[model samples]
Target: MAVVLLLLKTVGVLGFISLLIFYLKKIRLYRAAAKFPGPPALPFIGNAHVFVGSTEDILNKIMELLDTYPSPLRFWLGSRLFFGVCEAEQLKIVFTSPKTIEKEDLYKFARPWLGTGLFTAPASKWRVHRKLILPTFNPRILESFVEVFAQQSEIMVRQMKVEIDGDEFDVFNYISLCTLDIICETAMGVTMKAQTEGDPTYVESAKRTFEIFYTRMFKVWLHPDIIFNNTRLGKDQRECIDYLHGLTNDVIKKKKLELTFDSPIIEDTKPRKAFLDLLMELSNEGKKFTDEELREEVDTMMIAGNDTTASVNSFVMLMLANFPEVQEKCYQELCTIYGANINTDTVITHEDLHRMEYLERTIKETLRLFPVGPVLVRYVSEDLDIGGHVLPRGSSVVIGILKMHRSEKYWKEPLKFDPDRFLPEEVAKRHAYCFVPFSAGPRNCIGVRYAMMAMKTLLATVLRHYILKKDRTVRIEDIKLKADVMLKPVEPISVKIERRKH
Candidate 1:
């Protein structure tokens, strides 16, 4: 009886002490946050509850706050208070100003997958990888990949073969499938054939990865027990992540085995132009990227290059379907440059790609409406001040990209879908960094040029063959979204397409 009574007393005492500590922390946070602008947060939970389910809502909150709050809105996540940085002038401070915001914890989630690569690697490793892999983005590689992209794009055109009076069929899947194949073909020297094959391994894994990605980001809201135990998101995420690891391991194993017998791997066997081949060649020379290192880049390329870019292309088609006049302009632009005889056999060259300026503007507008990476996060390594607020070290600051895009000061009719805003003169008038679909600074997407070329080539090849119209089922505004890693349409985006009889 005495032992049981003692145990109960001990439990009560521990609970009391924890409560005391929590209250003390909250008092200190309240005092620290008095100088900044934000909604009052409760003791332990913080403001994570304000924006749930969709990051679009979080983006909306950030947007509302951006116009009202100064550049930095001091907010809390548990006991830690962070100053969210938004203004373009301040972006230079955080991204370029080496001393203040030296570390990036935004991509910490990716560390498990893409360890110490250009994306999230430490300063020293980043320098080495950045320099060594610099040649991958060279003109030679870009040119070679363009040829590969054009070839795959032509194959895409050949795959679509149905005719009807002006009508719409689901083409988002088609574009996604093509890009999926293109990335693999160019990067891995493997053909996915996702368009022709109904259930391709790579494409399925890519889609599943997005779902898993959303779960990882979204589950931050629920109570720890709810999130980890007896939840669909948590359970399924493990399987998907495991599958991704398995795929990368398989690819790495294949590459290593090929390297043993063949000098260039591609030269002795297939002569295929692949990122793996280039990395292997460099490894053979002197710079050997370990299996894990190569896996990091390969996984990054798969997710970054495939999922987000495809989502934008899907939205672009949806926009084109809505505005036939814009589609007409894009078509006319292509016809003027490529001429009347363009068909499945047409090989789109790198120089020819530069001429399609109208298509480029349309894509820019699409990116504006549905920015793939809406929020950019950075970790403060030291105390910093910007736009009248002081941010301490280890604060996870998020830049609201979507809100900035739609800000009244920078954009007129911020919600409207207008391609003319991106005209050479108009674009020049705006701040250079205002339009950042690929982000900025040292961590900006390296595949921006590759994505643009692929988007243009495929748009040229596909739109030329079909008249695209929006399906009645999926409207422009109402198309639901799962806002997590990359914002994606919740349902399969459908567009009706009729073959253009020449």
Candidate 2:
């Protein structure tokens, strides 16, 4: 009886000590985070409640917070504290800092789907991988892809032609499928035919995977592997991941059998090497990227290359539809480039893409309003000073691109969609990091040139053939946005496309 009593007392003492340590750590974090302005946080839970809502509601709440708080604001998600910065000066320190290159814990949600690909890998591994992949996106490589872009764009134009019966439809669906086909052909050397086909398993799996990851991010209860795996959402996530992996593996296997290392093939005479072929060549040489590494990169490129460009294309189309004047200007620019003979069959060369300067600006302005990734999150590796606040190590820093883009200080008539904001004179006056659609810094999107080529090619082709008009008049303020892995509109962007009178 005495021994039992002593054991109970010992257990109680240890538990008390553990509780004390936890509270002490919390106190320390609170003191450091106290320096920044933010919404009041509760003990233990912090500001986690703010994140509990539908994706659209969560986005609205975040926008509200951005309006209320100053730059370098602090917020806690359970015990973890995050610093949110939306000003250009503050962003410069975050993006350009060599030490702050690591992505935040929030990116871990993508691990199951992407593995440790370029997007989610550590700074050290990212450097090596980035060096190897840089050549894959060179101007020559991207120039070769113009044909693929033009071909796929023609397919998209044909598809749109079938729908141009003076009726409105969600433009995102067609555009997303077209991008899926483009990425598959250029990145994997496989034609998914997603544009012609209703919906392929690979495309569906990718979409489901992103949606699952987005859900896991905001819902704290769904974070732990043991608990999540047991749930229906978790099971769905695993199946989708497996399906995507299987599809990529099949593509990789087929490509390996066809490529030969010894052959010194001429660039023009031989077929153009896909991005996967380039990666395989690196592996064939002494600088070997393992099969797993290859898979990660291929998967990353497939997902990243498809969805982001698709979102931008859809948004740009929507913008053009809503503003007829802007659409007319873009059409005029296209007319100058192609002359009166411009048709759906027009082949868009690299030189032709550059001449659509106004259209490029419009794409930039669209990105400013609706950045594909609304927020860029990084893991603070070392103690840093941002906007006079001494941010301690081991905290997450979120750069709110949406907030920064629309901030009154950096933009004139920030809410209005003005392509002139990117004009030479206007651009020169603004901070270099102020307009980062593809992000800025050493880790900025490696696919920037490829995406631009694709967007310019596709948009130029579509505008040449049709006049896009909104089906229903919708104001920018009325359109609701959702905070997923990517920024998405709650309602589909429906537009009416009319055949141009040649």
Candidate 3:
């Protein structure tokens, strides 16, 4: 009986201490941020709890929460304070000063999967790596990848033939494999077995990596002490990253041998035409690039180049399936433009993409409605004067990118998936900072042109050959975005396809 009494007393004391700690955290952190409009936070956890469902909806909720609380909205995530930056003026202040006003620590949690790649590295290294690799991504050579883009896209079209008989099709896996193949070929100079021969091992690893990443980011600790100490990555996440890098490194080594050839792309004397080969050339005869630097740049490119493009494709496939009229329009345009020669060997030039304005608009509209990366973040490196106030050092300044895409100030019908809104003349009227499918300021996505070309080419080819119709059970909002590396539908983007009219 005495022991039972002692145990009850211990429980009471623990509860009291928890309350006391909550009080101190509120007073020290949130009260200090009370100047900003925001929802009241619980002791340790903040808005992090609301991220349990579809990726886009979770971002929509974040946008709603910010709208409810306006600019400089403050909240907590496990005793840590975070601010949701809404005002355009404040976004400029933060994005333009990535060297000072912010860093990319949001990716710290992603390190187990991506190492110190461009997204995870510090400003100094990122700059060096950026400058060194910038030339390889030059728009001039971007035309070269068009054929590569067309090839893999045709492969996807061939695969879709089996499901084109009014049967439901899950596009999430197909689009991922397509982009994975493209990136593996173009970025690493090697084609993944998954895309070429229908192997599922690489595909499974990639999906599991993303799942574990999400779990680590949101799962509440079993106890308090577990939160404060260094939280190491799960074994699976580490293995996934290792396998990805090992595959890339092998490809880079193989591509280096052909750099001695005069022309990287010629009729008879074959040379490596991939971006990885380009990086190898710069690494060998360079003032700045070393072996390690070369690997890091390739690593960054490989990781960034694959998932985001795939996510965009996955999103558009779902949208096209749901909107039959829009899908028909796109299909008709493809017939007029590319005719019937859309296959794995299709070699489209950059100029060809420019002619497909309707195609571009469809891709742009998809990005506005369902951005592959919904939120863009930065950590304040120094004191930043934003909007009306100054942010202290070490503070994080986050932009609701998906919110801005839907901001009423920028669109006539913000929620509608109307591609016509992006007409050349109409595009000029929108705010320069708004509509950031790839983000903006100096840190705007460098792969913007490449991503656009790749996506448009694939979409045009698909529309040319097949008519996409959504499964009756799927709604636009019903497609949950379960994302880790990049945004993807939580459920498969199931659609029925029919061979298009010639």
| Winner by lDDT | 2
In the range 362-434, model 3's lDDT, one tens digit per residue, is 8889998788667766776666778676665555666787677777877777877899988978878866667
Off by over 4 Å in 3: 1-32, 43-61, 98-101, 218-233, 256-272, 339-347, 471-475
Per lDDT, what order, best first?
A: 2, 1, 3
TM match of model 1 to true structure? 0.88
Q: After superposition, how far is residue 109 of candidate 3 from its true place, in Å?
A: 2.2
Model 1 per-residue lDDT tens digits across residues 1-502: 9999999999999999999987775664466578777777775667656655454465456556666677778766555566666677777666665544334443554565566667677676776877887788777778878877777777766766653554555665666778888887777777667767855566666566555554444334533545554667556556666787787788678877877866644565664458877876777788668878888877777777777767888888888878888999998887887686654456788898889898999999989767887776777666667645666655657777776776677889877789999999999898877778788887678888888988888788777787788645343456555555676666666677777668
Superposing all C-alpha atoms, what RMSD in Å does each candidate have to the true structure?
3.3, 1.9, 5.0
| Per-model lDDT | 0.71, 0.86, 0.70
lDDT of 2 at 377: 86
TM-score of each: 0.88, 0.96, 0.84
Give the least accurate 10-residue stretch of model 1, judged by summed lDDT.
Answer: 214-223
